[model samples]
Target: MTVILEATERRILQNPLENPEVLIRIVDDNQATCKSLQFFLEALGYEVRIWNDPELFLKEYKENEEDGCLLLDIRMPRISGLELHDILIKENFRLPIIFLTGHGDVEMAVDSVKKGAFNFLLKPSNEKKLTETIEAAVKLSIENHLKENNKTIYREVFDSLTPREKEVVRLVAQGKLNKVIAADLNITEKTVQQHRSVACHKLSVRNVAELVEFLKVLEG
Candidate 1:
């Protein structure tokens, strides 16, 4: 078990998108099912958590938890997977979700995907399919987290700029030359150049291409 776990960890580390820190939350009423999945997923190097009660999971879930995906069983008691998914959406939850369903629930699973669930798997899910789907979902979760983090950083940095610096950055992103910006702003070319240089330095962008990219985060 130790050797297999170590090997899986190494394999996950080698993939750029896969991180051992990614948490996998499983919600199912069946104790046997939860135990089986916890063992399988942990062997693949994920941190696994299981809940036999959907309401308990909801009560304990933290909205701003670390990067991860939810492995939810669709036909749980008290609160169905689809109902929980709707609640999470209304709560602005961030983690990607993959639903586990039996063969008869295929249509419902498809509808969930249409409504923005990451994906779904039939019960007795094939090992290869489960691994691939989880990998993709976790990759998406990490990417989204990075994008939001970058947006926050960019917003703070942009807010720190002087008004003139912000203006110069906007014009530069619009592909205006320094002399044109100077003329438009009734300033000297040297002053425009200085503003551009200071702005670029503050934003840590090396060139116009990077500057444009930085501005895009702010715009978005």
Candidate 2:
């Protein structure tokens, strides 16, 4: 199945200041199910945490200390999926949640969606469908991680430089733009131009914007 991310989902992923380590939590009452998802997701390069019981999962994740999305079974012992949803909010977990149910119901589905569940899936799901959904979630997690890391000193240095020498960022971000920035900074353009020539050589950026974006990732 194709994965669909609404504009809102895209924006969440695009934001640069989101949490890194958006962890994928899978909660079900079956060990086999948990293992199946965990293995598939780990193979797909996601960070996954799994639990075979709702009570235990809630116990472990008592606080909203986790990142990423949740894959929760709609039916479980101790607490039902809806109850768990309430618990998640009451505990202040802003993490997105996706529900899975062996017996899907319209009212239940509507309520869950209205309450911010990512998507609801039936049991015996297609691997492709699951994978696609996971891909969307993973993309959001990584993007947020990148954004958070980009807020560091490295990113500050990266953002502080002229838009041009950031092109020489390999050298300039490292303090190399002695001549190029001189012209840009109106000081001794030749100084960093020497540095720019070297910056261009080292950072391999044809220009500064690329250097800035690269620096953001490198800071990650």
Candidate 3:
């Protein structure tokens, strides 16, 4: 089966208000497919970085923490695409991921999304569709980086808390009441109350629920 991408179709997908950065990391075992897509993306004016192996890709990431989204192949030698995604997440690289796979790998592609892929496209996909998805992913990567930075800034509000208050916060997030927290920590109820008051004051949260909501953002 072939995906039709017409010559008249737009090569570019979206206009960037600010010049967007994209790093096309193609980790396909096949040289032809990798080169072909790299050519397509470069023709659209993106900075293309082709990789025939995952180790080289990981080495690049380890060296440079830069602005970009990954155009990843679903199946590759040495380190699989899904494995690379896991490694990136573990290393705190939140850039959006777009998986490319063949028709026979539909289930694997669907699983990739469940595991945090931005989107998956069929191999030999329509050129227009490919560019459109890549553009959306770059936009999403920018948004994700912004939100991650916001969370880092917000987390600083809680940094002045004592080690005990930190423990209290973790328990509060677990829905433990003050009395339960006291019993678990072997601390007096009054001390627990004092810690809660201080945490709320420093965090600028009117109540426990707001603090929980704030923590939820950090998890994302």
RMSD of every candidate to native, in Å, equals 6.5, 9.9, 10.4
Structural RMSD, model 3: 10.4
lDDT per residue as tens, model 2, 1-220: 0012134445656642243445788888878888988887778666688888788877787554555788988778888888999888877665668887786788888888898787888877888998777666656555554355444534554455566555445545654445654655566666556656654545445666665556645555
Better of 1 and 2 by TM-score: 1
Q: How accurate locally, in lDDT, is each candidate?
A: 0.82, 0.67, 0.73
Best by lDDT: 1
Q: In model 1, state the lDDT of residue 185.
A: 95
Name the lDDT of candidate 3: 0.73
TM-score versus the correct structure, for each prediction:
0.88, 0.55, 0.58
lDDT of 1 by residue, 1-220 (tens): 2234347545554472465457889988888988999999889888889888999989888843867799888778889888999998998888989888673366787788898899888889999999999988887777676667667878888898999999998999899999999999999999999999998888888888888878776677
lDDT of 2: 0.67
Worst 10 residues of 2 by lDDT: 1-10
* After superposition, candidate 1 runs with Cα above 4 Å error: 1-20
**Which structure is stronger by lDDT: 2 or 3?**
3
lDDT of each residue in 13-61, candidate 3, tens digit only = 2343244455656677778988888788888877777778887888876
